[model samples]
Target: MATLRGSLGEANLGRLVVLREAAGLVTDLVGSEQPVFAWLVHALGSPIVMGGQAQRTLYVADADLVPVGEVPEVRLRMIIEAQNETDFDAALAEAAAIIDVKQIDDKELASLLEKAAEQAFLAHSLALVATPVALREMGFRSMAGSEEALQFKRAHAGVELRIDATADWLANWRLTGISHSARHAQYSEKLLPNEVARGKVFLAVLQIWREAFGNAGMPECLELAVLYERHQASMNRIHVRRPVLTVDPKVFRAILRWMQEQEHKLLDPQGDVTLAFSDGLLRLATGNVAYGCAAWGDWVDDCVVVRQDLLALSGPLARARQIRIEQAADHLGINGLVLHRSPHSIVP
Candidate 1:
C-alpha cells in the first residue's frame, strides 16, 4: 500500500526496465545453485539514491511488482513477471490503443500519456518494494531524530530564543525558534548556533536603544532607526516615520561604534552626546566621535561592543540526552536504512 512518485527520465526509465527484466531472471534462479541469483540479490540490495541531495533509498520487498510515480514525457506501465498472467498489461495497452485511434485533442492525449507515466512510475516503485532482498539487507542500526535533541531557551530583553542541539558538533546545533514582543516585527529565519550567538550583539544594540528611548517613545533620527532595522527591532512595527537609509557596511560599523560610545557617555550626566548624519558625514554631539568618509575602512582597534566574557556568562543550553536508535528506525519505517551509528554525538 506504500505509494511513491518521482520524475523518471529516459535513463532512469531504461534502468527500471532492465531491472525489471533482471528480476524475472533472478527469481527463476533463486532455488538453483547458480551464483547469478546471489549476485542479483546483492545488486538489488545495493542502495540507489532516488532524488538529488534530498534522496531516498530504493528498496525491494518481494519479486512480484515494482512501484512508480510521475515522469516527464512518456509514461510507461511495465510488468516483469515470468508467469502467464498479463491482465494489467493488456488493459493498459487497450486503453492506450483506443485513445490513439480516436480524434482526441492534444490536451486529451497528453492527459492519457501523463496517466500512463504515473502508473509506470507507480509500478516502478512497487516493484522495488515487492523485491525480497531489499528488506533482508536493511539490518538494524542507530539513528537520531528531533526528539533526541537537547532543547533550551534564553531571554534577552523581550526576545525569547530557543535552541536545539543534537550533538557536540557546532553544525549539529541550531536556533530553532524565537518569541519576541508582538508589537515588534517578527522574522522567519533558520540560524546556525554560531549565528544565534552573533545575534546577541544585535540584541544588545536594541537593548541600548530601548533603554535610551524607553518603551513609550521611538527614536526620531534615521541613523538610530536604521540601527533598529539592522537589529530586527524595526521601528516600522509601530508606524514610526523614518527615512530609508542605506549606507556602506563600513559606515554602519562606524555608526555602531558611535552608538556604543554614546551608551558610555549617557552614563555620565555631564557628557554631551549628539548624533547626526549629513552629506556622508556622521558626528556625535559631544564631538568625541566623527566619520567624514563614506567608507570608514578597518578599525584602528577592535571595536568589541559585547565582550566575550559576558557572552560566555549566557552559558550552554540543556544537555543532550541519549535515546535508543531503534526509535529512529521505527519513525522512518521502510523509507530509510539505518547504518552502524549516526555520525553525531553530544558532549554532555
Candidate 2:
C-alpha cells in the first residue's frame, strides 16, 4: 500500500514498489545519483535496469521483465476498502488526472477506473490482514502456522473471505450455502435450530463489513449466490447493478446502514431485503416453494433417491427467494423438507 507522490511518471516507480510488496518482496526508493548499477547487484542483490524518459529516471528489476506466466484474469466487479483514506484518495486523484476522463473515450476511462479498483482491492486486502482483529470480526480464523492464509468455520455460514497472493496473486472472497454437521459428520443444509440459537455469526459479520468498508464512496458490485433445490442443490445468481458510475457518500452510507439494520429480516423467508442506492436498487426475493420427488430402493433397486430437475427460476424474486431459503436453511435450519434433495456434492 505504498503511496505514490510526485508526477505520474515518478508514480510508476511507486507502482512497481507496491507490486513488489504485494508479491512479498522487499523494495525501497533509492537515489538515482549513486552507482545504481553496482548498488543493484551488490546491495539489492539483483540485476536491475535503469532507464530515463523526459528527464525522469526509472529503475526496473531484470527479473520483473522476464515472463512469469499468463496474466491473471481481471474481475471488474469487487468490494474493496481503503487502508488509508488520504493515500487512497491521492492515488485515485493522480490516476484521474492522468486519464483526463473528459478528453478520453468511454473505453479508456473505463479501463482506468477498473484498473484503479483492482489495485485498491489488493492494497486494501493486504492492509486488512495486518490487523488480526479485523479478520476475526470478518469471521476468519488464521490457518495454523500461516500468516497469509485463513480458514472459515461452519459457524460462520460457510462463507470464506481470503486474499491469496501466492497463486497468480488473485485474491477473492466466496460465499457458499453449505455447512458441516458437528455431531453426525454429515453435511446438512438445515441449521438445526440449536445451531441458530447459539450465535448469529452471519449477522455479526455483516455489521463488521459494513463498518469496515465505511464511506469510501467507490463504486462497488457484490457478487451474490443463493442456493436452491429442484432435484439437486444449485446456486441462483443475484445480480447487483448501479445506474451511475460514481456513487455518492450519502448513498453508500445508506446502503451499509440498510444492510446492517435489515440483518434479521434478510434471513427471514417472508421478509423482503433490498439494497437501495440513489437511482437504482436490488431487492432480495424470499419465500419460494421447492418442488421435487424422492424414491427409495437399493443400488439397482434401492431407496433414498431424489430427482428434482429444471426448476428454472428467473428474475430478482427467484434469486431473493433462493437466497432467503438458503439463508434460513443455513442459519435456522427451518427449510428442511423431508423430500428436498441434499447438497452433498460439496462436503464442507
Tell me each candidate's TM-score.
Answer: 0.17, 0.20
lDDT of 1: 0.32
Q: Rate the local accuracy (lDDT) of all candidates.
A: 0.32, 0.29
Across 45-139, the per-residue lDDT of candidate 2 in tens digits comes to 11123333221122333333322233221311111122234446876898678768567777988897798776554343332121222333344
Candidate 2, residue 55: how far the Cα is off, in Å? 25
Query: Which lDDT tens digits does candidate 1 get at residues 173-276?
Result: 22233345766433233332211222232333334435433343322322333333443444346674322223354443444455455555444323333323
Clashes of 1: 27
Residue ranges of candidate 1 with Cα displaced over 4 Å:
1-107, 110-246, 267-348
Clashes of each: 27, 12
